[model samples]
Target: MPRDHSHDPGHHHGHAHSHGPATPHPAQPAPWSILRMTVTARLAAALAVSAGLWVVVLVAMR
Candidate 1:
């Protein structure tokens, strides 16, 4: 049986795409900061959220 993908862009009719990785890797390598906890994006986002909450609380008190 043959998979006819002549009308599609993602899937090929032949098994040509199998020569590459099953999925394309990210364009950019993961940063060293992301590999550590203290400098990770999640920690930065959390700190930003905590600072925003403090600002809201200060405004309410005023």
Candidate 2:
């Protein structure tokens, strides 16, 4: 019986085999620093809570 030569390792059909060494990416900044909320955010939160409290107080007083 004859052996098949279609699955030889010497043939690649013009495809890349080596990708070379991987380079390390630059360090990233702190995720908290990137998404840190400012004073305006706090003010908006306070205002929302104040408005909600005022509405509840008015409803209770009624």
Clashes in model 2: which pairs?
Answer: none
TM-score of 2: 0.42
Taken over the whole model, the C-alpha lDDT of each candidate is: 0.73, 0.74
Q: Which stretches of candidate 1 lie over 4 Å from their true place?
A: 1-39
Q: Please give, for residues 1-62, the per-residue lDDT of candidate 1 as tens digits.
A: 99876766676555565445677844666665544665567778789999999999999999
What TM-score does prediction 1 earn?
0.38
Question: Model 2 over residues 1-62: C-alpha lDDT tens digits?
Answer: 99877788766657664544375545667666514778888788789999999999999999
Among all candidates shown, the one with the greatest TM-score = 2
Q: List the residue pairs that clash in candidate 1.
A: none
Alpha-carbon runs more than 4 Å astray in model 2: 1-35
